[model samples]
Target: MQFTQIEYFLMVARLEHMSKAALELEISQSSLSKTIARLEDDIGVPLFDRKGKSIHLNEYGRIFYKKAKKALDDLQEAKTEIQELANIQEDSIAINVMNSKLLPKLFFDFYKKRPNVKIRQYVLPDKLAQQKLIFGDIDLMIVINPIVDQRIEWVPLFTEEIFLVVPKNHPLATKESVSLIEAKDEMFIVSETGQNFRATENHLFEKAGFTPKIAFEGEDLSIILQLVNEGKGISFIFQHSFLDTYLDNVKILKISNPVCFQTVGIAWNKNRKSSFVVNSFRDFAISFLKDSANKDFSN
Candidate 1:
């Protein structure tokens, strides 16, 4: 069937009223009704059940609706990709990133490579990022600690060790590193339940047979850092998430001997078809990281 037919079907199915759907589509009510009838005839199934002015999509229609939405999205993505290939213009990339210092380095590098394409970045917590990726709200994600899901394909970018953020004046700040047992009683400023970081923190505490006195719970890294700076509580975060430049009051200390580490990665829906541009970006990211890692190793 034609795209217009599918559009009309979706609108009518959503509105459930011929007049309302027609008004929304800027078409005559009779024309809308006729088009629906024609579509049903063409498809050889009754798509909607009429109960006076109200209507509901039949089982076949409900199934068709799901497929139709995916088809529409694919068509739109294809059109965008085609236009982008024509002149490398008018394309946008959406990425959900777990807020971290390395994010800017990655984003700026990608932007330098593709100045024409608009990059939409969403700072999502790990759990929400995973959820969004699965639901197709985001094209891909750069998560701090990768979460496994059947719907996503994850590629490892790197691994980073977790560090404790303590105020410089705090007693633990003088030490080069601290163990879980040493910091067991310290009040913690932790990420909320959904994030993998929070999960790790909780796991460590559970392993050590202690529950930290969590003073603040949030998803924002900056906020978590700020709380630690204020001496409200100490926080555990990935080293990459903390910039080395300097914080006014907080000191980032490594945790040992069982170093807490998390793998940072990019995740995208497995079922979604990859465009050449997306593939290029992914390839570039992989190659760039490999080269960078090799350079570091050689040095």
Candidate 2:
């Protein structure tokens, strides 16, 4: 009946465990249990099918859960609308990106033009970024190999080829191009499985009909490059990821067999209403990237 009770019930329903939900909600287990019991009593039906310590949502609970979630989402949207109206002059936008290196220059360029607008950036894995977009936690996302979703509006930014990187002194370093199968037995370093680059690596290896011997799995691109510099293992990297600093110790080769490439873009939730600042940034970013890509092509 109460908003707090509904919130607690939703959390319990999501986690399906009293102790875990209580810990997450930062409330005592007894209080959480009493709250849910009261909610069930008021509704005149048991929401959960309880068996010992585990609980699962029954038919009634499933129907109510969807309604309660939507109610909370509506309340959150209302709060965002009021906040935007209150601060119409100075606006803030939240964005998530797969790569941190590309953001500094882009954010700086935007900040120089729109000094009053506040920009918040987050670097997250692909799965987490998509989740935040779905929940309306972030206004926009800049990503590569974005999963296709009906709820999202994707604007293409640019595409770049993925390269195979190895230490300059490695056996295959002198080759103009290398097939993925040739390197099947070689030690490889790759990003964590959820990342876009990692997915591309897996696809390339799969197409070449061999599994790579993964020596290290890391999240940071800089560290991955450093590992290659030390002759620890080779890795797949994006074309833009190759900096002059890495040129001395590393050699980047094209993948001849499959010729893989990834398209990076900006994605926004179609259902979430964007604030004025968020709308402005979305337009500006799309235009800016399009222009940049055009100039690169012309040159």
Candidate 3:
């Protein structure tokens, strides 16, 4: 079957309506129908069930659709890789990251050093970023709690302490540090479920033998901090120099008992071949982080 036929099949499989798929594909309904029929004939099995002018994938169709979609995706990825290879001198580096706040400085520093290198950065949740790295959709990832996978390698960057944050006027705000169990009854603001920070917070609470009463859950770190500033609830945050800007009405309390923290790292898939620009960027990032770490210690 033609590659276009596979493309049409996937489109029809997704929409499950011949007329709708035809409209979206900008092809005549009859032509789309013929392509689907020809595809089924070539495979020697009826892929879809037709009833009352609507068509839906049957078991055979569902199985074929999954494999066909993956095949097309692989082809597209190959084409992209080929194009990147052909234009290696004007390379673009794609990175998936957890923290976007650090990217502006990091990207600008890299750009200043290598003016021709293009950087594409994405700030995604922990699990989604890991998925992108594993799928070779991105060249690298900056993340916390790097998942242990044989296909992926992690380079340790640094570790930051996780602190319990509270509104300045809260009862526990005056203390230098507090235990998770001490605040067990207090309402907590936390990141959404799949994030690394949220998971770390949950683990700390669980270790303290209690689950926090979540008052609010958000995807944005700034929003979580805002909720704390509003005295909605207390939450956990990584200790960072930049956090001072957001802490005018909030207090960062140390976690004395569990001493919760997360290790940040750069992760990349070992199976994927690195282009010259990708390698150079990776080396530059490692050197930059090392220098920054040394400066932090010297200060």
Candidate 4:
């Protein structure tokens, strides 16, 4: 019933553990448990199912969780609106990217144009980033192949192709392009399983009708590229990698058969109110991507 009680309940519901939630909220576990018990008593229903020391939000709890989160978000939006009216709103945006390694130049470039705007960037997987986008916790997301949702606005920013890479003087290094079938026997350096980059490569490999002979799998892209650079194996690389990466030791070849390309996009909550600064940056991003998309990174 109370504002603080609702805040506590929402946190407990999200974490699904009293101790973890208390630690996050900087309060004692006993106090958080008592607060949840009082909240359930006031609501006239048990919100969580307890087993041993663990807990799970029940059906009623899920319903309340959604409604309570929205109510809080709406209250925050109202406060922001008031600040905007007085011309005192903060100029900032929070963004989460799946492949954030390719974005330093973009952020630095934007900073040069809008030095007064504050930016917070996070590197997260596509699905988790989408969840935070829906929750209004993040203002925008830069994702590859975003999910279709009614409450989210998705705009295609650019398409970046995947190219085969090899150390100089390798057999296939002289070729301008190669088919996946032709390279099926080549020992490849690839991303580790369960990685987003790996998932993208996996899909392209599946569509190309052959599994690669992987010589090494790494979670760190720098290490994988290093392996390719050492003549240990060949690998695929995104075109955007050429923007900042030093590829003088490696030869980047186009993938002719599959023409594997990833469409990157900007995603945001359609219902969340936006500030003038956010809108300005969105426009700047679209223009930036447009210009970059036209450049050829194949050299």
lDDT of each residue in 1-299, candidate 1, tens digit only? 77788999999888888899999999999988888888889999999988887799999999988899889989988887777666456456678876565556666897776777676889877777777777777777876555577778888887666778899899998998877778878888898888777877887777666778888899887888887888898987675554434468888887774557777777788888765656666777666755554454355
The stretch of ten residues in a row with the least summed lDDT in candidate 3 is 80-89
- Per-residue lDDT tens digits of candidate 4, residues 57-107? 999999999999999999998887666444466578888865434477778
As a whole number from 0 to 100, the lDDT of residue 6 in candidate 3 is 95
Q: Give the TM-score (vs. native) of candidate 4.
A: 0.60
- Residues 26-78, candidate 2, lDDT per residue (tens digit)? 99999999999999999999999999999999999999999999999999888
| Model 1 local distance difference test score | 0.77
User: lDDT of each structure?
Assistant: 0.77, 0.84, 0.83, 0.81
Please give the lDDT score at residue 281 for candidate 4: 75
Per-prediction TM-score, please?
0.67, 0.65, 0.65, 0.60
Better of 2 and 3 by lDDT: 2
Instruction: State which candidate has the highest lDDT.
Output: 2
RMSD of each: 8.6, 12.7, 12.0, 12.4
lDDT of 3 by residue, 1-299 (tens): 89999999999999999999999999999999999999999999999999999899999999999999999999988876666545534678999866434556778998877676788888777778888888888999887786688999998886677888899999998899988799999999998998877778788988889978988998778888888998899987775436457668998888888868777778889998987679878888877775665565466
Model 1 spans > 4 angstroms off: 1-87, 207-209, 242-246, 290-299
Worst 10 residues of 1 by lDDT: 290-299
Q: Candidate 1, 152: how far from true, in Å? A: 1.0
